[model samples]
Target: MATAKDVAARAGTSTAVVSYVFNNGPRGVAPETRERVLRAAAELSYRPNALARALSFGRTLSVGLIVPDIANRFFGELARALEEVAAERGNILLIGDSSQRVEREHEHIAAFVERRVDSVVVVSVSDDPDLSAFADAGIPVVALHPLSESVNASSISIDYRAAAASATRHLLEHGYRSIALFNGPTESAGSRQHRDGFMDAVRDLAPGAAVEEHSTQIARAHAAQVALDMLARPSRPRAVYCATDEQAYGVLFACHRLGLRVPDDVAVTGFDGTEHSAYSYPPLTTVRQPIPEMAERAIALLAAGEERVRETVDFTLAVRESCGRHGTDVAS
Candidate 1:
């Protein structure tokens, strides 16, 4: 393997000039010298040492991303989007899957801090995730969910309450007098927002709508089990609004197991419009969070500085077969 010294020797330049050319640098190299270094590097296939650069510049040129459940389609897509954006910015993204465990989440946080990642993007399972570690280490954090002001971090998320309300309203428009809410297990800020939004929609738009709420782990199997019992009730809801597509999929499974037809017997709507949602049995109608846009903005904000800003992006309701949309008409 060729080294920077070999490239510099072939280019007839000092190692410092090579460093300036490769690092884009503290010191300027002549245009002609820069071209020479590039040509020699191409011939020698010499690669710069990332560790050496990081040691000198105090930046790993990497971002750490922690998600509650990587197996969930929503987080999987989010990770991919974040990785793309980070790569475009000349940085690598390190992903840590917490699997809904606080201890595991903390372990990832510590690992990132030890690795000296420039910043972190987190989707924690806890309401008040301990960010003091990152704060003390001077590593900025950007959460992808609703966070309290006391957390000492920035957050970028869509208005979950409003989004949830909108989805519930869609069911109401379909004349679903009885609607059920399938929310996440934990009582985090994000969960509260989902609950508030769901109730608000029922109160404001469908005052007479009979509403029932249930909670389950984000896993599809767990949600399926919870849904099986819910749908088996004599007073089962006509429509269900899920906090996530994962849960919605489980609801669909429960519906099938009970020999109930979708949109005919019961309708369902999901949050997080992942691509897989499109391919679900009945094509789920969902609230689409802008993953690419959110990822790009989050990366930009974290890379810029530790400016404690709470940002909200736009979300859209994707009308599809599951919600029983008539013609081109969609429930918003």
Candidate 2:
């Protein structure tokens, strides 16, 4: 409970000088006096009130980030990239995990607004999240997922449909006669795009090949459980394309438990190509999202004083061991 008064007393300065030093204010202090004040504050364990400073200065020099699930690898990577960018810009990043709950997302949003964060980045659970609160508070927000046009926030995301189709087309190129789509459970805008791209690829491959759809939560354990049951059946798919790396890893585990060799007995592809995908038992073939680039763009957009604009980035398909060789050999 040490206050600025105690530090000012120890530093032989008035509280006004301490305030000016802490807030970097209208009045300038000599370097020696600033060092003395900082040393006294450190010795006395004195802390300044962030709220009062923000109320006066209109910025906390911080950015808030709300993600659906911080445990998910894709969001984890995004958070890390954003942190790096924020640090370079002399801003701190505060992470808030919604844990896939809309109420929790709202709670974080309200808290960030009350705390007066300079801006926010969110990956909301709902397709149409309540962004008006932040908009009213004049806090800029950027979403990392597909958002509706009416959401009134800047968005930076890769074309999920095209990425899904590209990965599916890669599977088709391998001539996997029976392909499966392991997609997200909810039929949100993102999931719909994934389905659209997947179906587009299937239709282009045409009537000769068979396609099936499977749904699971975006977690490794859940996806593994679902994949295990599906792969246990006699008519299991020859190749599976998962919407996320977590689901893809789960499918890989299911293949191992079922004694089905990957890219031999059954091939698999994954989206959201995180770094860990390369280290999976068999390096996975996945659609690589430009995470660093996306992070930079999203932060820049949120920092910029411009009208809301939605932008879509491109994704790259990383062909690897799990998708099998790219030769003319047809899948069994």
Candidate 3:
């Protein structure tokens, strides 16, 4: 059977347009586009049974999820956890990967709204995404990160600033003075929190510790490249605090290639504790945002139909071989 994506391809338009032509109304399709969609649907024998059911029951039974990069292990884990939880609730998850592009993010936003998914979960590329379309469509939304109070949506996220600070403090207690912060590429809400938290630790713990910051695309390869350049410098910091485990892996890779030992030469800590963190060359110390717990709460919040529910979850610092045998896990 032809799927909406198939019809979209045949029509030379987006799945959203096919949805608009089939579901009608949340938005209008241009006459030419509508003709193309109809012709494509008939030729492909496309039937939107889901849309029909949604209309009949007044609920889509599907939830839309938007993430910056689906391939990133953190987001990949998040998607999988969300899928499992949503499945238990009798709703399927429709995921859209924004490829870390604002325009691509916009496309997914429009597509989700047009398809009239019952609700949405966003791990947006932007710090402050435009939730107006979802708001106008009356679809409930829950952001996995903090959001401005002005936005008409709920948020469920770990306290990133505190998480970062805790990780940095752990590194300081390890007696590494000069530390570098490997942060996300953009200076958004997340990056700002990471920066502030890192500085907070430096100011209070190490006092005059040497610190520097570098930004990279949230990918291992990009992070490796950045790490190589930064670590190649003669005065490279003795320890590094990475915003994500993926980046920490890159730093580890750089250390290997540069003949630097893990804690002996350059200690490191990471955030977003994907399972891979435990098995890295030197097991990584990281701040773990509880994925399963977060997913359960997010799904329950959407199911409850609460207008706006802002919630925070605890993050655990997994002390492992990477930051020098801190063996105990700390939760906050």
Candidate 4:
């Protein structure tokens, strides 16, 4: 392996000068000297030791991300958007998938802290995740979900309750009297917001209408199974509002299996309008999170080096074929 000493010799400079060039310095090197050292390092295929550099500069120029499940299309799209923003700022992004496990979330937090990543963006599995470890280590963090006020970290998220209400209200406007809410597992922060918004809309629109709540895991397959059973019932809902596009797709599949026509027999609205949502069989009507804008703003906030600011972005509802709407109209 090529060493810093070899590059220093090749550049005709002291090892300390090479260190200053690579670490961006406690002391400045002349621009010409910096260029010479960089050229020599490149020619020699010399890479700075990340550990040594971190010890000197206290930054890895990298951001750590922890998502509950990367395979989920929403998280995958979020990761891609965050990566683009991070890259534009000359930072590398390291992703850790928790796979819906709290232990794994903690493990990733520990790993990122130990590795001294400059900042982190986390979408935690738990409603109130323990992030004091990162705080103690002086790592800046931004949660992409509603966090407890006591947690004392920056958060960037849409108003889930309001967004859910807008989606459900759209269904009500279409005169779907029998509506059901297919939400995430019970007792979750996200699930509760979705359910509350859904019920609030239904109560205001049709006081005596049949409204029910169904819980399922965020996975499409599991939600599909649950929806199949639910739709098989004679009292199945005429319209459904889902907390996520994944679950809405599952319901769509169930409708297909039962030979039911969408927006004719059943209308469905989904949240988290990923690109794939538009490509579904009936072209879903869903709530569109400003993911790219949110990702850019989150990275900017973390990079700003100011810890006191928290930001919340707005969401929009995309009306399309599935919810008895023909054109793509946005409601904010």
Q: What does the lDDT read for residue 323 in candidate 3?
A: 83
TM-score of each: 0.90, 0.90, 0.84, 0.93
Error of 2 at 250 (Å): 0.9
- Residue ranges of candidate 1 with Cα displaced over 4 Å: 4-21, 24-44, 206-208, 327-332
Alpha-carbon deviation at 150 in model 1, angstroms: 0.8
Summarize candidate 1's per-residue lDDT along 1-332 as a digit string, tens digits.
99888998999999888999988998998899999999999999888998789868888999999999999999999999999999999899999998898899999999999999999999998877888899999999999988988898999999898899888888898888999989987554478889999998889878877888888888779889998998998999999999999999999999999999998999999999999988999999999999999999999999899579999888988888998964342333
Evaluation by lDDT, superior candidate among 2 and 3: 3
The global C-alpha lDDT for each of the candidates, from Candidate 1 onward, is: 0.90, 0.88, 0.90, 0.88
Candidate 4 ranges beyond 4 A from true positions = 23-39
Residues 1-332, model 4: lDDT tens digits:
89999999999999999988887887999999999999999999999887667666667889999998899999999999999999998788999999888899999999999988999999988778899998999999998878878886889989888898899989998988999899886745577778878888888888888988888888888888988998999998999999999999999999999998998989999989899998998999999999998899889899987775656688989899998968666656
CA deviation > 4 Å runs, candidate 2: 10-12, 29-47, 326-332
Candidate with the greatest lDDT versus the true structure:
3
Local error of candidate 1 at 183, Å?
0.8
- Kindly list the per-residue Cα lDDT of model 3 for residues 190-251, writing each as its tens digit: 88889989999999999889999998888888989999999999999999999988889999
Q: Look at candidate 4 and give me any clashing residue pairs.
A: none
Candidate order by decreasing lDDT: 3, 1, 4, 2
